[model samples]
Target: MDSCEEGKGIRTLSTVCEAAETAGIHMVPNNPVQVLRFSEAINGNVRLLELNPEVEKSLKQGDRVVIRGLASDEAILCTESKSFEVKVVETSNTMLLCRDIQTPGKEAFTASQSAGGGLIRQEVCGSACSYLELRPCRGHLSRLAEVLSEHQYAGPETEPDNFVAGYTFRDLLDLVQGSEDELWTGLKRCKACCIDGFWRLLSADYFEQAFDRIVQSLAEKDWPIYEVPVDECCELLTDLLPRVIIEHCLTCYGKKNDNGATYCLDEELVSQFYAGYLLRRVAKFNYAEFMEVWQQTVPLGITVALEMLKGIALHDLTARPPVVWHFPANSLPYDVSPRFNALFQERTKWTLSDLRPYIEDLATPQQPLEAILLKHTRSTMDVTGQKLYNSRHPL
Candidate 1:
């Protein structure tokens, strides 16, 4: 039985070792103990859970811990701020769970009041041949595209239809396979908002329009990209779009300035967003023509580079006149095996740089990026060029 906490903010407890260290401590005789396999003993009902120091601390401090997923789906254990994949690992040896077993080293301090005059009978409640282990994992969020895509925020005119879903934040949390922290970040990436009472994804065309308005407004006033007046932009677009949406676009593409009144646009993120918009609308684009248009798409004074498109789009330079196609990281599955297969299916052989961004999220602290690549990919290299990886097995 667990000890009960007394009333008020503080309570008292003691250890057997503390009592043993005290002066004039009386030594009691050890009780005769017997391990009995009770009639209710259920094999595999008990399991050992090993938690990391951080998780233990969080548990001791009364932080929330939840397990998410359907019975058919793989389980994800989530703390308040982090998520981990729950894995079942088998052991060769079996361990039993006994009810009312005395502490192994506290026999000498036990009272002579055993159940039957120092005769202690412990009944086995359960046994286990496996344990549960935790591995760090990115939130399983591919499902977000399905849940929020039902109602896209195209415009205020279409707002009526978009609100039909009526799914709130709690609804998303209940079904989405991510911790609270991961869920918020995923929502931001998907450009989703709690408009009215429902969660909805803002359409790409809408994002493009809002972004263009901001850029053109700055360019007309000859204002530098670094010093964006957030209040003025919000006020101007307040009627056309939600203030939250307006602010969200800015936050996605830029960070706040030190003065705290303005923001500094991140040229790379802005360019990437626009480029992704174009790629998503088309199956593929010619390499030369796409580069020329992409360069023009970004804000003035913001440089565009083919190198910056990693993880967003894949260029088939080996094609005649070359070709570029969208291969976004988000569209891929979260699990490692499927992601690797999808990557190789897109390209038979990929240079390390080209493949890293696609599968980087699958790497964990115990299983790092290099370890993952080595395990799943077959690698070969030239004399001085970058190493190339192919599928470890035939697809």
Candidate 2:
């Protein structure tokens, strides 16, 4: 017989590997024990042979016994006897490891209840492999009903109100496995069909299947899928905008027109151009001061400068006739104006000579900006011409 003792972190004397030794069970550590059938009644029960000699002599076959020890993966076997049964008493922190059970509608309802709002809830669906969300609105409910209504596995009612019969991760997996193109098509079609968000309603199985397909496709084409979290993905996309714009201009509008003039007629392209121009300007004007500000501001300074340049470019580009404006020539790196010198002297006790070299090092051009710009622009023009010709004639 088995008995349980409950207390606050009480240390109880018990056998360690003695039970396994008595049973003559030989097994490697960390190996899983095969359980043919689990009898709840037999849990926590210890056989008479498993007890120490002193404890066994003090108790009879029907007497209750309690022993405490650390849990392990080793299986208990009987040496003298082939098989015997023991009664259950208690259990401790136990974890079940097995393939997830197949239960349609169960998970969806559980998730819906957990989310507890009109808003959609995102969660890892089947086996926690991919994200699945729940969409709980009339439109989605209607669509779901329409799709499953004709299926043999679908329950009775076919109306939107009756669509509350949720879906299972297994069903979604089978759906994708059978017809992937149709699944993608359905997902796109259903995007606006649900108020709660269509993807949110997708079963975990479907999410995993679709995600895997996407990854395989990208990999085959030598593309990488960013394995970032959703929020991080959004952040990266935002950071990429400026760089994307720059690349687009270099590819599409970097060439000289028939009049031997390069023009940025596109509003977005012009904005990007001005942003680069401003950064260059700031660096040139007060090199040391700008560097200090840049160090302090870090990423915000870049974002702010880009936004300001974009605004200026937009205002200028919308004028009656677009005009090409030349950026002002930058002052010599070491040449401090009287205004700046007086201001610095007032703010700090440093002399102009003392600060001049540091400022020059920060902003001094190894080669003129015009020369560098000309080289880059010329290379872009050549590439654009080739691209244009290729587009016109595929061969």
Candidate 3:
């Protein structure tokens, strides 16, 4: 009878021979070539094992294969993927700031609003979204139903109203004077007539800034007016003013339809442009995270991307004052904030206006937007000319 050691040796020999056979090489009679054990790591702890010279010889550089060590015959096959860590030496402030300010949540919130409020969260700062995702929809009706059920206002005689008793629009306006969210909340609580009136005031391009007209008309009409108050109104003004500017500029960015007079915002083109812009601007931009945020808030991909670019550009232009050109202080707009005017007081200043022409050129496609964006993506790589350029992916 064979000893236990002899049996173990026989099994080892059997495994080696089997592995050799699987690799399409036959062992010489009473002769076994040494097995060259190879552990090629694919990713993380996962590895690709090549047990014999025959197996290694059969594999193309990137070919996938099933492999087993001598211990057992069970094998795992995986495609060999090469990984490399890419490092960017010098950090650009433009890219860094872009990454910092690309607030996906904020952009999403803005999208919910723009999409006629399609998203409704119970803890949202404001009111409900509509069924059709447009204003004046059945979505508000659902909210009304909830409110009625909560108040037990079920009787036929109980008229549906948005009135907050003992609170005049003026008084409520006073209460919400400090907060944008409060203003919107108060607006939600007001009677339907008041909400409609307040909306009208905003909708009219001419009446937008005519505060006296807005207030006096609501008061005279006896419409319960809920509005952003004087202090908080400044914040709304900044938002509103930029929105108007962007809407107007967006016209220039669109393509004229076959009819020539009508314009269509080439949503895909705009998205590509925005992607480029994001890549150019945001150094540590994560595509997955950005897409996730964007999907929830504003699935209208192009519009949201355009808004993001607009918001960033407007902020950059407004925040620290212009550094591009020099202009006299006296020539600047007088009613502007003294602090803003002060940016130009001492030096010949390139104002926001000066930057407009360049922005317009870029928008119209006269300038290569991709090149500018690529410059940003390329900045992160040690090499140039489109070599493995992923800003977010390390490998």
Candidate 4:
């Protein structure tokens, strides 16, 4: 064995090359250069390993040959069973390089762009949609209904039943804009008829003349004249006119009904000739005051009236005033009272002329006819404990 000790305590040249062959040292085919493990004894020695194949073949047995130009940490072993040993010289310059990089797919990239665009579109659409909602004028339809329901004096009803059908507030406004002349004509006739009805109710005796004057006035004003359907006009007239008369009677005399009798007059009904007489007189010069009184006092009087009518009880009249008396009497004689005579005289005098302006004034403030009817109907029911006005049965 060619044994030798090298730098850094390395041992070299052992008796058996079996271990070296098992370490994977091998020769490349068609190449004279031999590859083997690097050892410290080969340091600074280049000529032996780099020698041509001819010189390697001529090397004598037991010669001390040192390998060169190899890395210090390199190791190789023989692939074959033979104990052939060779020295490593140079290595190949090829190297492997690894790295990581990310790339987005086509679908992912498109979706990102689409999401950004959709957000912008939604914002623009929201801003534009805010102003597109509908906004209507308040009480417009209510006013139209009031005018249509009140106007009683147009010659016989001329328009089709469908004239006011399907009429919304928007439709009424459109109608007002489109045919203002027609609307105004309708309004004027309605106002005239309402005034006429109001006067007649206040004083039943003057009803005929009051109605004629209303028509004549409308004709003079060039308002289209047509007679309203009797059925349609009757209930409205009854409600409005009777209330007016009742209010006038109540204010003129602090009296209330009792057992089919006018305040002081036992033989007279409150609604008979005396109501007309009082309407003609008291409601004549002070029309506005009469209307104010009606509006304020009629509701209360209706409550009282209904109660009295509902609760009739007999009582002795030994100490009461008389039934027959002159106008403006302080008291009635013979079972009648002074207050009753005064009320009868006051309420009977109101004529159409006396009540016209108030009706006109009342008519000017437009309200939804249905809503007005509902309110008045509720009031009547509340006072009378019965439905006096039925919208379903308007007549």
Q: Give the TM-score of each candidate.
A: 0.78, 0.13, 0.16, 0.16
Q: Taking the tens digit of each residue's C-alpha lDDT, what string does model 2 give over 70-186? A: 143112211121111223323354323222322324564445445541222122221212221211111111133244333322111222663433334334423222122333334
What are the RMSDs of all candidates, in order?
Answer: 9.0, 30.2, 29.4, 42.9
Pull out the clashing pairs in model 2. Answer: 23-77, 133-200, 134-200
Selected candidate, larger TM-score, 2 vs 3 = 3
Off by over 4 Å in 1: 1-52, 87-96, 104-136, 161-166, 317-319, 382-385
Best by TM-score: 1
**Model 4 agreement with the true structure over 8-114: per-residue lDDT tens digits:** 34333331234446786652222222112333233232222234433344354433222211254222211111111244334344221112111234453345454
lDDT against true structure, model 4: 0.28
- Any idea what lDDT model 2 has? 0.29
Relative to the true structure, how large is the alpha-carbon lDDT of every model? 0.77, 0.29, 0.31, 0.28
Superposed model 2: Cα runs more than 4 Å off? 1-162, 165-167, 178-395
Residue 101: error of model 2 in Å? 39
- Candidate 1's residue-wise lDDT over 1-395, tens digit each? 11443244222223332444586565454444343545453656676888977678779999988888767769988887788898999989987777566665455215533432233445677888889998878778777778888777776767555346646887887787788888887777666777767778777788788777777778877777788888887776677766777677778788889899888888888888878977988899999999899888877887889987998999988799799999888778766788888888888998988988888767767789989988899988866767889999777
Kindly report which residue pairs in candidate 3 clash with one another: 162-191, 325-349, 325-350, 326-348, 326-349, 326-350, 327-348, 327-349
